[model samples]
Target: MTKPTSETPAEDGAALLDDVERFHRRFNVFPHEAAYVAVALWDAHAHLLDCFDSTPRIAFLSPEPGSGKSRALEVVETLVPRPMLAVNARAAALFRSVSDPAGRPTILYDEIDTVFGPKAGDNEELRGFLNAGHRRSGVTYRCIGDGGNQTVQEFPSYSAVAVAGLGSLPDTILTRSVIIRMRRRARNEKVEPFRARVHEQQGNALRERLATWAKSVQDRVAGAWPEMPDGVTDRPADVWEPLLAVADAIGGDWPQRAREACVTLVKAAQVNDKGSLGIRLLTDLRDHVMVGIDRLPTVAILDRLNALDDAPWADLNGRPLDARRLSRMLGEYVTADGQPIASRNIKTAGSVLKGFYTEDLWDAWARYCPPPSASPLLPLPDGADTD
Candidate 1:
């Protein structure tokens, strides 16, 4: 999404209500996911007129084909101001535009991998732009002008971004994006109708409302910062800085909830990337920890964890269930409060594991593996082999 430079912090906002509410209502948008979109597109709206400053870029990805990624983008297209639909542009032209620091409108790309089709690393140029869009420092490049002049210009960078595609994007992009994983609706489930004109009217109203709100609370947005969330320890400043700013601006339960949601969702996606954990990861981790493992040998404990048909040990780490990751994941399963693993934390761990087990992955463990009791973290008793 592209933002114009004319917007001011104190400018009156007349857009949020219609755009945010409409998008929220029309689709079964996930709360965390919807917030990301709202904020990014909100920046786009501000840029269009003259309100707030930069914002995070958005990406919407899904596990497989037919996960409604394009449909999600349809909603974004209406809400975001001056969105650049990448798939519609010719690849060479798009890269050239992006290469120029002044690439305008929001750069919206669809079927990105496919769009960069049939060429040797054809998409590298485009990727560079998307990578930079997330951070001001990240958005710089040198392009030879029409007169064959070489100029190094830093492109305008803002949090205004959104992309949707199958599964996860590349790490360079993923690190910078607030991703929304699109889901496939079951045969029995459905959301209300959102045709083009209807979506447009609804989105326009939202934009107007949010813009109005921001105008009214411009001071609050700049000063109403809230308490920072815990466990943002390992996150990047680029990722958290704007996020915290948004929270500070909102200054209510939303600030805390939004930040926590970002941490949880981002981490879950990372864990899911590793392919080691699953819904079973949460259920099994709880089962194993509760059952106890103080006296159980590492091998026996491994056996039990692998035994869950719901959670496969081999899939945990493509190579094997190594001691390090296993121990780390177990340790991370609980928070400082020692509560059962929250669903979101489990998601983050699973995402992280998915990244590791990407290639040459072994199939899941055989069914009905045993559960473990408490342990003293003992070594294997004899020559007990895990494989």
Candidate 2:
């Protein structure tokens, strides 16, 4: 039977939502290397609106106070619809108003960290707002009681948000963000024009067109969400669920591509266990120890690992790395024939233990440690002349 066409409005909206790449190709222009980042942010923003509809994102770009972070946002403001630019001073009140039942705002806070970076108290203040807004939840607090005493009250609000900063933010913030690291601009490269359109009436018309189309396909955009891959099963159901919902509404290749994009983006911004102590690092350590496919005394292995005297980890403060540290670090990685080892410069039982390991770190850590050699032993000299 023919598959049913995505009949939902949200799904149709996903299908109708603007494909960012089209604009690039149409202009015969390729964004800088960070263009993929731009796409991810754009997709997140679209999903933000489609999901919460009124929840605005807080997108930030930071670089050493002057790597043109603000300038980048200038370009973004020019392109995005209904952009609300706010100085850090105005950010909290802007969010409070957005969270207010009367008029919720979608906001952009530029250089917000400066306000908090000065002291721990300031940091605490920003953290509260960030924690509260990172994912929309009902806000509750004490209100005045009927007897002129304080009373607790709480209310719900839907407000989508975004924030950007230099390097990285606190782990709490990172856990809930799509990070973009802004690099310093090159000497001779060019940046496109950035400005609010005044004379161009057509820009407004296009924005209206895009917004209109977005509103029309809301339901179908939601349907494709159920099919997203399993890796992200752990995230809160509130955030990406809606974003994926919008992606599914678009159906066909988009649902898959968008899913990939969503996962890739979030994963890129996150720090994983593999990244800090990955296979490469592990392999390098194993190589230093000279592990093979056999058994050896565990003490020998520790000795060899301790042999490192000048590796990066073992380097003394304010002193240069010495050769012993590097050697020691490498020694810790050595293993035996299917068993771990410390060193191999000695014999086991009646025979000399031969070479420590026949394979290198690259192969060993990929878990492809080589087999012991099977070459025939050399024969004794037949009849040497009397000395």
Candidate 3:
């Protein structure tokens, strides 16, 4: 391990983060440069978790097995503080471990899909733990003792958590995470074989250095309000704040690199988001189907939505989206004045029909959908002319 020779904390911090990034690069074939930056910053952030009010869980997710998801968690385990790698762990055991007086452990949860996947029956207890743990004061109330002697107790659940799994997580957990979509290495993307015996010591050395660097900048990180890139706001802002704070403290190409990663990954997640079918419907209506139209009758709206080859509206629940489904889905959203946007009677060419007025949808569009510029994340529905 090379010692940081710089006299200033910023200089030393930059050098240390660079070393961490390079170390991860040698072993992990990340999907993009942003993934490397995020992982490295996240590793450093774990050391300074107490400085921030909320800790974002870093998730390495893949669509199938053997995509290096577990390997990514393994690499992270060596670098975080008091790492507790949990697989098939009971909810009781996890919350107990987190609330231990020794200190909160950095949780590296592998095979997390099994706890949230189709075969995984309602594991609501574990789900609640993961959700509540994102904020500093988050906790779970548990009953302890035997029989009538049992009493309710609050267990602190806040901790730096990283999870790896075969598929996506629930929307609640996903919104609070820094998501890394991992893929299997191709023939030419060579990486050093990560054997625990040979490489764990090297990683541990880096971890120690990271801890020292984190201590040096703990105060600065605590007070940092790192500026976010354009279009990165709301939940995305919360998720990237800690990683951006770490980059700002380090002070190098990192600040620039970190923002770039923020934009790239946030956009990727929005484009590939599988949660909220209703949001998807709203975005589609605002961006693709309803373009340049003031009022669309229910029949016209259904035709446009169902025509989209890539959208799920055409085959939702084994049937195409109908008038009732459309109204129900749209009714789920409200206007700025807090009234639900519902279908109304539209008099079209002397014929009255049930449809939606563009005026009613404007507020929901502004509040729920990303601006039109970001709409390209999802391609225009199949063969529909945009011009």
Q: After the best TM-score superposition of candidate 3, give how far the Cα of residue 189 lies from its true spot, in angstroms.
A: 1.0
Q: How many residue pairs clash in all the candidates, one count each? A: 73, 57, 0
Predicted candidate 2 versus true structure: per-residue lDDT over 1-387, tens digit per residue: 122245523323333344443432222122242334334335434433635422323335454655655654554443455555666644345545655655454445566565554342246545556555554563534364687776766433344444545544554555555445555656654554433464124334444445555555555553444554566654423335565565555455655665666666555554331232233334334555544433333344445544665433333466533444434544555433444323354467786642333332333453532222332222212342334
By lDDT, the better pick of 2 and 3 is 3
Ranking of predictions according to TM-score: 3, 1, 2
Q: Which has the better lDDT: candidate 1, or candidate 2?
A: 1
* Candidate 3 residue-pair clash tally: 0
Candidate 1 regions exceeding 4 Å error are: 1-22, 28-54, 88-104, 115-122, 145-159, 216-226, 234-237, 275-387
Q: Pick by lDDT: which candidate is best?
A: 3
Candidate 3 structure quality by residue, lDDT tens digits, 45-74: 999988988999999999989888888888
Predicted structure 1, TM vs. truth: 0.57
Candidates' lDDT values, in order? 0.50, 0.46, 0.88
By TM-score, the best candidate is 3
Q: lDDT score, residue 149, model 2?
A: 77
Ranked by TM-score, the better of candidates 1 and 3 is 3
In candidate 3, stretches whose alpha carbon ends up further than 4 angstroms from where it belongs are: 1-11, 118-122, 291-293, 335-338, 347-352, 373-387
Off by over 4 Å in 2: 1-68, 75-82, 90-92, 116-122, 140-157, 187-189, 198-206, 222-224, 236-239, 251-253, 271-387
